[model samples]
Target: MRDEQDDGRGAALAELRGRLAASVAVARLNRTQLAARAGLGRTTVSEALSPNGPVPSAETVAALAGVLKLPPGELLALHRTASAPHVVGDEGTVTADGPGRAIEGYSPHDLEVHPAGPGRIASGCGGVGGAQELPGYVSRGHDRVLAGAVSDAAAGRSGIVVLVGTSSTGKTRACWEAVQPLADRGWRLWHPFDPTRAQAALEDLHRVTPRTVVWLNEAQHYLGDRAFGERIASAVHQLLVSPERGPVLVLGTLWPEYAHRYTVLPAPGSDDLHSRVRELLSGRTLPVPDAFDSQALAAAAALAENGDLLLADALTRARDDGRVTQDLAGAPELLNRYHNPRTPAAKALLEAAMDARRLGVGPHLPPAFLTDAAIDYLGQTDYDQLTDDWAETAYAELAEPVHGKQAPLRRTTPRPSRRSPAPAIAPQAESRLRLADYLEQHGRTARRHLCPPASFWHAAHTHLTHPDDLNNLAQAAESRHRLQWAHHLRHRAADLGNTAALYRQAEHRDAAGDQEGAEALLREAADLGNISALYRLAVMRERAGDRDGAAVLARRA
Candidate 1:
């Protein structure tokens, strides 16, 4: 009976492959072209049509069918027939429909959607007449363009749409609203966030099925990986161009800095660090203005008159600032909390978080770092007045929810270690806190000209783990003419394999008359393929009369 079952399965799979091969031939597409168009790996496409290959999944069959301009239903049926005998038990049985079975990620419709807000607003303005939630979204010019893009995706044209704006600007809310219709239309939404954004996308993007929405909130996390960002960009580009496997909508939101990073063209002869990212985002970004225009304010006024008390309050208060979205999101309350903490220690903590954010620390702030840095922001008299447990008290007060929504410092659960391949082990206690987005943005402009104290640098060096942050601190220290601190920071960054830091260290050594040491550092950087390091090495060799070596290094650069 087993032998007969095996024979039957083999014959079924052979028949499926035969029909698929015939379809590909009819479409005049080779295996490579078919794989690219179907968003399948080249090997996957080849195996699906191979005589000795295993039976392909229903999803793969459907993708190939779409690319070949054949009906997916028929192909899916053939795949099921070929795969049925391989099932060993009831637990192993496969289904042909339903998102849980067919799709591999979250659905936007099922998500708990909320409009842009500081946290969650329990009340509108006065405690007596407050809104339970944010006011209704007032459609803006950019929202119309975003909605049109979503509509195009619904019509079977795969594409990416990125909303670029600063924090608290309703970029996320707009995207959430744009994709809501697709959710009702049976589209699957995939948000790749597990071990890490880049890792999750790279690992599972190839298996993404048709009629799916790739939700990339805070898109910088996905496309900002120094190692894997380009690869993810390439994968997304392939997915968009793959005619058969799409009707897929890639929706993303980015802060202005990150948007500029990915979209800006490199200067002439500079290494194209964001080449693939630039290509992926080309002609796809729609800017979201920070403040509403006259037309948008008028629309908000109409909504406010229609019983949106929250919008009414924002319009009245934002008359001076024109930051209607910020008002609705409780930015004023957040600012008030920061400026008027119950204790000086709490205010100092808020200042510390703001400085850390403005000085290039990642969003996840360590409590130890905050505690150590906060003292720098306080006066000697204020610092001397603190109790032994003042840090604990300040943190608790800062973490307390305001307006029934946001806190100055929001506690966040750290993501699982990206280095670990096994299941995540929970931390013994919460280890990190996040500065509220509204506060972070406010500090960028508020503290842009201020240099952080030595205590801030020390806390950051000891607690911060990301190389980028360390490099940024080193640059700041260099600009302040604190060469010793800069050297320490650059060394720390170089230890973490930051090529830019290595190159900078080389320049510093040369400036200090350590010619041999500079050459050694430059060689290390050149070996890691740092373009600037290569050019520097060429210059050093030419100065030493090693013309042949200089020519080789210049050519390599």
Candidate 2:
């Protein structure tokens, strides 16, 4: 029996060798002669080709096949000769039963590998790691805010909570850690605009398990831009309020200005600066630990001392006018007007401190100057601006005496009655738009996979620009990897009062060989006073044997 098996295997091997040799012999020779022309060496090729010998490595076989101008499968076939009259190639298959004798079969998908390109692909904003656990890094207070925000979102206070800070200040790191525990417990993560890999995870939010935690890095990109913000806000409202879908908990991180622009909170209130700072600390125990070494404590205290003043003044400016928060980021430069050196010393003090070392040593330094190096070392330029600017603005506003008795309170505004209209909610439009924007730039696939435009604005272009959304959809559908789903989204978008969506539906219709249907959708969109939709309807009608209809639509558009 053993001899019979060995003989069978040898026959197979010899056949494979013969086929490989034949193929190689017919091929042109290169630096290395074709394997068929030279024949395989006894020591190496013979053993590899032998029935009892090990099968050649994939790389080696492929190399040999290349040299011989032969298909590797042909060679492999000879090495495994079958007794049956019908010889099955090595790429064989078998099916298995599920729970019983009945079975289902599946084909193996061969993956093609491609080299990575220059630009970055979005990944779920994993994290940059934390500082408390690492040396040479300060523990930013954002961790507390993130932890608490996640708790709040899970508890059902709906809406996005944005974390704002400077670069390398741990906002992304803190958010990642805070959301991980929640994710393990079944919270899904959604990201819209991922300037980096961190934000890419949002693409899967719709398909992920319910009860999600969305972390949008650079969330502003989605919110503050053009057409993108509108769609995103609508999408967010639809998903979060959907009866079928579970709640989507969101945590967005961005620079302070963006956070100010997109946060649900009102712009920093007069006292809200302190509140903001405390909130940033995430209710973490403050009066910071004595456990911290003295130098570290001093540094923190100095920063706090200065920060409080800046916040108070900034918030006050905001109350008087809406522009203060926008200007706060640039307040240090704004104080250039107040840099007089010889003035009364909240007057001269700041400049003296700034110029003290630069001005050279003097036996008699002015007493008016607040020359504390500690303040300078701790970054008190803005803090000084706060104190001086606040004092100037407060005195200017209040110094103008009231008609009667006591001066009107400096920073207090009486509350309105409950019957008054409440403050308008910050729109979710920007956030939604940003996500769409991200998708348009980055999706690709192996073996012909289709993806929607990552950028919401880009996707909305057809309808938005031409009012022929339906035609756009039809055209898109005709293309490889048809974007039918996007067409659906565009149609629905119009019904939801989004003019851009209506226009897109018109474009989709035109693309589907239904110019009349396209014209009708565009008419409705235009009737809604969507100028772009109206214009597109007219153009599409003119192209489709309806010159008079095009003329009327053109006038309307």
Question: Best-fitting candidate, measured by lDDT?
Answer: 1
By summed lDDT, which 10 consecutive residues of candidate 2 come out lowest? 106-115
Q: Candidate 1's residue-wise lDDT over 93-167, tens digit each?
A: 222221222222332222322333333444433222332355688888898998888889888788899889876
Q: Runs in model 2 with CA error above 4 Å?
A: 1-145, 154-159, 183-188, 192-205, 259-557
Per-residue alpha-carbon lDDT of model 2 for 56-114, expressed as tens digits?
A: 43334555776666777766555334321121222111111001111011000000011
Error of 2 at 430 (Å): 45
TM-score of 1: 0.45
What local lDDT does model 1 show for residue 435? Answer: 83
Question: What local lDDT does model 1 show for residue 205?
Answer: 72
lDDT for model 1, please. Answer: 0.76
